[model samples]
Target: MTWRFALVIQPAGVDDDRRDFSATFRTIDPAEPALSVGELSTQRGDGIFESIGVVDGHPQEVAAHLDRLAHSAEICDLPAPNLEQWRQAVARAAEHGERRGEGVIKLILSRGVEHGPAPTAWVTASAAADFTVPRTQGIRVVTLDRGYASDVPDRAPWLLLGAKTLSYAVNMAAIREAKARGADDAIFVTSDGYVLEAPTASLILKFGDRFTTPAPTGGILRGTTQQSLFDHLREEGYETAEELIPVDLLARADAAWLVSSVRLAAPVTAIDDTRIELDSGLTQAFNRYLLTPRD
Candidate 1:
């Protein structure tokens, strides 16, 4: 397969077969050009976005992912994106990538690329590389001292805690530091000592006879897989609960796992130098169910 070129073109409404380059003109020179004035000033106006994984031609829990995007948009004070329209855009982006057998989809909506402080909106979808295997090996993670930074506590600045947003500089920095320190991922805990979350996913623990994860109110992003696991566990005679787990609790738990759209459910085999002495019996039980999802 010889690679040719990647072109970013055809907004949602464009005629795909017409090959009309005239209507779909480029503003900033793809090679080098200055961003428009509005882009510079209105970058933070208001927007909603989403990222979903297309595996074996399947968009894993796409509906759940969009619900989260809409929830995050509302939290960010952004205009609600048309749900069905966005869905189609993701499908198109996934299809555009020939490797639809397995890949990632990124959907972004920001203030319209036009000028002024207007509440305009735009959407862009693109293919992404797949990196789902490493997450299964159980990523090495580090804990951060700062409980996620927030502007106003009353607004529950941590509301964005779980919402996946483009504003992820801090999370990236944390991951960078972790990699610098030869670790795989990072975790942050609230000052009160409750385990907050991983840089990009929700945290959970597998204790005796139970599957425990933090509740949304715990300032953690609502995890779709974790929710599925709850349903999965309940049917298998296992109990699930959301508790304010002490950040340090992970270090003491029987076993720890990071749950998200990509990883699904990955065990934290270790925390720092602390070897997670897991009670595999429970994991074996869950694995049986996971291997053949009821869905």
Candidate 2:
């Protein structure tokens, strides 16, 4: 998590002109203490964020990430971020880096100090970790009960399920628990035995020639990487779908992957104590497509 560059953003209103908002971005020392002790983002995790993958000097899927950021803001009741301002901010931060092999750009908007004037926003760029082992050799996973039904999102909007909020204590704990249980990652399953998603990635299961991910309806954050892969797969003439996947379906999957912005696509070699075969050719193809620069 070593940041190469950071920028503090004086976020503009949704109606602000791009030319006027460009000056609001200011580069800052990544190691400097820039946050107040009373910031709600640090105190109560009251914020939303998006992470965009960078290849060479290009920021991938900028429009999709910004769209998700706005959606998260709406769900969390934060101010509507001016997309143009954030777009320029992301570009500025990305350009501040070395523009080498792989990197990541993160856009964060917090609720600011507890009773302060306005929200706090910033962007950070960092070199992405080498995921060659996970991408090539694959990873082991375990399923954990998320303590809610698949319909919890519809039944409890206040939970802020689908939004990519900063409140990730539970998600981190889940990953730690998985590691303690002798696995590399964890997949969240509904109390009623339905597949959801990973703590930090989206789940995609393949059955024969068809690929399916859990429907975004079940408190699952819609994955930008998964969507892009789906589009690519469709272009390649492969069948893809989003559906309510049952937990038992994992045992029958021909192949599976956990995809994210930073790590790209990682094959799942085993689930729980059951060994699942890895699709090497497809995995390589997925990573090849993912590593390429895409807007």
Candidate 3:
């Protein structure tokens, strides 16, 4: 049977501008069976989405995120959201969520919502989830040898792996595999041993006196936090490079860190059981730069 669902709106208040925006859903009946965000498998999965952290009621790098979302929707052939309408809707949900002071906001757009066995465009918002910085102990991660499914052809041929899309099953599965090995996350690596990125975030590391991250060309998302750090550090005379990174070599580096919107900056003390120097001049500078409040 076809299912219905409700769009849950989280209002913005407390510190936001108090503007309101509404998102959507099908209003599925609670009596019916349910699948999870990571469990849908029957339909052609074609959609786009992004998650941004709300800091003191503001979404960090808000303009860049909106631009990326719109670009991703275009690449996936999803209907363009009326930017004006979308802005207002997100504003409303944030206001209703009352998580404006400190929280995370997820903006999702699906072209797989069906009315009667056929999918249609639908946009929705989840209630604001809690946001907190992760610990400094750092996360352990595994490297994935293959991307997506081993056999199925890539649907979004234009899929910019860097764009935040809702098609995250592969990423989730990679994390599971990493965890089975006692790691906290997963990293995607090319067959030749070049580092692509971690499952959900961008990877960055220090090699001697320089800081580097995988190029977006290698399927790594150009992260806002990474971008912020690059710019902030460059002003301080740190050289940043965007190029192919050999996985084996990063293990021999002075230090490494994976960056994200909410997790902020997490340093890596070990990789595949190999220990790394966790404290250094570069990492200390990064810590000082990252601790500043978001611009």
Candidate 4:
């Protein structure tokens, strides 16, 4: 896997490095030591992250992602991040990887070391592989129980249900289980049968001319990509909503999708073993909508 580290170089004699803007990039050596054992994020999943889709050097939905990242930090009780620093890093990474046409800019923030007050932050850029098979051909998904009720987030703040934390063991495991079962991905449903979200993406359902997704209060991470697409759809005169949706309703819906930053919008062709209807035209339209540069 090729990786590039974004480096920000301050101008000579610039006391306030925050305002400086010269970006430098270097290839990251995989064999080099990148982290210490004592880092809290390495010792424990004590961090938050954001994966921004980069197209031709520009990061889509920059402000929205930063806002979400800030919200994640607040939820994790970490110090307020230097937003300017993150922006610079992302810009540097994007510039470095622009030649690839499309890629991902990953921003991470950790709670410093095990015994420190500072925080660890960095950005990495890599060319995104074409997931056209899933996006164009659609994907088969299995429904897995998230082992938590829909009301868990409202009742228990310590669980960090709504926050986009770095602890993705369960999510990855669920995907692995699905793959083992001969499926492409997994959709996490609540213990009570409410459809939640995919391991790394949000779920959206379409019925006739209406569109809806699970409410964010249901212990699901608020999806930035979904929200961006929703805004675009609403402006185009489509009926959009966010409400609690039962898993069974997916079978009756006109169509369904698994959307994310990098993957954009992918049609869900099957849930478990049952195949659902796929609107090839609508899916293509959604792909165009999502990939279109947002202003």
Candidate 5:
């Protein structure tokens, strides 16, 4: 990805005076090195992040992304991010880009350097990858065991399963494992046999006129894109829901998709070796709505 803009943020406490809020952001060269070697984000992946899709220079779903960022911070015991400060930062970062076509804005808040006095924060804007083929032609996925039960989130809070932390090594490994097995992506399933989510995206399955995603309760990051699409689907007179999904149900679904911020909505053409019929009309409608600018 080619970064077009970068800004280092001086995060403010919730109670801090905001009269000089603009001063909290400093523009920087995206190609330059601006982080310390001992930063916890680099050393231990101790941080939280959010990727907001940008369409024609407008950052989509700012409020939802910010809310998730705060939720992740709370889960990780990191200091609460002043939403107002981050909000302005996102707008500023978006302005520096070419403001055309599709792009993305990523917000990051780290635990900072080991033994340091404060946290580290920044934002970067860059052009998004071309996902036309995946969005139009669809992708094939394989299921991998996540090595835990569906109730693991409630049973083990210390694992930080629901937070969108910087610790994505395992998720990346899962995708690589899928590719090695002749698949495009991987869907994580509980050891006890329940559907979870894709490594970096939320899984949505359609049965007749009803659509369902794995309930967000079990360590799955609440997908902002999926939530928005659900609203759109509901308005179009389709039923949408979040519920526990059994692994065997993948074969029974009429259609399915793996949705995320940058990739938008990608239809799942197959699971393991089982073929799924792609709903071309619905997929096009979904991307048409997503490509439009939304606050």
Candidate 6:
């Protein structure tokens, strides 16, 4: 699928009103080299990013995404982003892709090269047809070991365990291994045998009218999409809580889902080749609520 992307570099200390699109923002050719050869984000994966879903012509949950991005950047020790500048860039990119239907806007912040004092920032909007089938048909996921104990983040601050940084080689590898094993995705279980999260999404387990997910304090990145879903569920008379989930709870859940910004929510029909309960009715409700604009 063809993608429409916007790449903008706003130098630090620049006023938003004085910025020039012609000079600062470029419509990137996907086939061309987008980053400098010396870029640390490429060389060392030292960056933070956020993927926001764009429906129709508007970016969904932009403020929440930005807040998460800021937190990630802060955790990565990068300079604070100019929210207005990033917002403008995201809008330009999302509009460029909206004509083709829904898409995703990715905001990337990188630690500049060792020789440079400024950071690098860019946004891209890409076609998102990949989620169509999985969202409707549900997905099969396998449980994988994350190799870190549940309480490791509390003891190791420098590990940056909870930050949504660009260093996702392990997460990518986990998903690849799951796909090789005939599953669509993978959920990460802590070394201590607790449910943590998924490679690219958050895990939510449903039992009747109650929903439970891992608390962010357990070193998981705070899930903006999952938070929105929990809020909606609460309003709909469902109970929700953030707690440490045991790996075996998958067998008890009436339904389970992997949720994120672009894909929204995909019900887990099977885990590790074991068939689990599927709640198409609840899954449909989640999709409707997620795709609907909040404001």
Q: What TM-score would every model get versus the actual structure? A: 0.74, 0.98, 0.73, 0.91, 0.98, 0.93
Writing each residue's lDDT as its tens digit, candidate 5 over 179-287 gives 9999999999999999999999999999999999999994788999999999989999999999989999999999999999999999999999999999999999999
Residue 208 shift from truth in candidate 2, angstroms: 0.5
Off by over 4 Å in 5: 1-3, 17-20
lDDT for each residue of candidate 1 in 182-294, tens digit (9 for 90 to 100):
88887776666666778776777877777788656626677776787788778878888987777667777777877665545566777777777544555454434433422
Please report, in order, the local distance difference test score of every candidate based on alpha carbons: 0.59, 0.92, 0.60, 0.81, 0.93, 0.84
Worst 10 residues of 3 by lDDT: 1-10
Q: Each model's RMSD to truth, in Å?
A: 5.9, 1.3, 7.3, 3.4, 1.2, 2.2
Clashes of 4: 0
- Local error of candidate 2 at 185, Å? 0.6
Q: Hey, what RMSD does candidate 5 come out at?
A: 1.2
Ranking by lDDT: 5, 2, 6, 4, 3, 1
- Model 6 lDDT tens row, 1-295: 4766768566444345655443666677756787788889989899999999877767888888888887887777888776767777777887677464677889888897758878887887887767767887899999999898888989988888888888999999999999999999999998999988999999999888899999888379889889999999999888999998888888778889999998999999999967878788888999989888753
Q: Between the candidate structures 4 and 5, which one is better when assessed by lDDT?
A: 5
Q: After superposition, how far is residue 97 of candidate 1 from its true place, in Å?
A: 3.8
Error of 1 at 163 (Å): 3.5
Clashing pairs in 5: none
Better of 1 and 5 by TM-score: 5
Cα lDDT of model 4 by residue, 133-244, tens digit: 8998899999999999887888888888877888888999999999999998999999999989999999999998999999888388889999998998899899999998
Q: Residue 242 in model 4: shift from native, Å?
A: 0.3
In candidate 6, residue 141 scores what lDDT?
95
Better of 5 and 6 by TM-score: 5
What lDDT would candidate 4 get against the real structure?
0.81
Return whichever of 1 and 3 wins on TM-score. 1
RMSD of 3: 7.3
Flag regions of model 3 displaced more than 4 Å: 1-42, 97-101, 115-133, 147-160, 280-295
